[model samples]
Target: MKDRATVVCVRDNRILLVARERSRWALPGGRICRDETPNEAALRELSEETTLAPIELTYLFQFTGFNTLHHVFFADVAHHARVQPSNEIAKCRWFVPVKIATLSASIPTREIVELFFRYIRTLESDNVHRISQQAERVSL
Candidate 1:
């Protein structure tokens, strides 16, 4: 199976997506090249497709598809930054989380977004638990 790394870049509660000519919209990513780690591939693809680099990236999740294994990451970008598509990309746009379901996106794009939200929720819950434990320690 091919290995790929995708970045769900978030800005103002929206995610970045790219579409190639006559293709459905998808996340900015591509197949991992030889001798490259997933994180390295992700950063490279993000820049190649969108001409915008991530402020930071956090590993979100991974899943195996029929012919590919996807390693997804979360990135935060500034809202004011413009996404200039490279030749391989036809167009790039940002969509709010709630609007993603209505877009003409590939199935993998939809699945990846769902996973991204789930990962964010998990992070929030973990942070809350850590805070509560810290509070209990202070009370002792």
Candidate 2:
């Protein structure tokens, strides 16, 4: 499987993404380096591409297709003050999920965008549930 890393960094309802000159929108990640673990490669790639460093990073899921494997990581980039493009990137921008398709982005990037929003939906639901429970307890 082809090995890669992807991240979903959301802040203010926008996701940090990297756009290449001749490519579609993509996450801030890349292939595993020759001597680096997936985590190491992910951190390095994220730093190099968007310059948005996550406070904490971890492996979330893997996508194996034919002969390639994608190691996905969901990162929180709240700590990053601003993001700038480095190598392999034409521009760095924050995109709302609905606006991603309007931009020139790759299929893999679109898929990652969908996954990120789905996760965000779940998180919102969980947050609402927790808030309701807390409100009820407080009323008691």
* C-alpha TM-score for every candidate: 0.91, 0.79
**Candidate 2 clash total?**
8
Where does candidate 1 clash, by residue pair? none
Which residue segments of model 1 deviate by more than 4 Å? none
Tens-digit lDDT string for candidate 2 (1-140)? 56887777777888787888877777788889778898888889989888777888977777664455778887766654788898888898888878988877767777767875676689899999999999999999
For model 1, what is the error of residue 45's alpha carbon versus the real structure, in angstroms, after optimal superposition? 0.9
Q: Please give the range of 10 consecutive residues that has the lowest summed lDDT in model 2.
A: 61-70
In angstroms, the error of model 1 at 32 is 0.7
Those runs of model 2 whose alpha carbons end farther than 4 Å from true positions after fitting are 65-67, 123-140
lDDT of 1 by residue, 1-140 (tens): 89999888888778889999999999999999999999999989999999987778878789777788999888776667788999699899889987888988988889889888887899899999999999999999
Top candidate on lDDT is 1
Model 2 / residue 89 / CA error / Å = 1.4
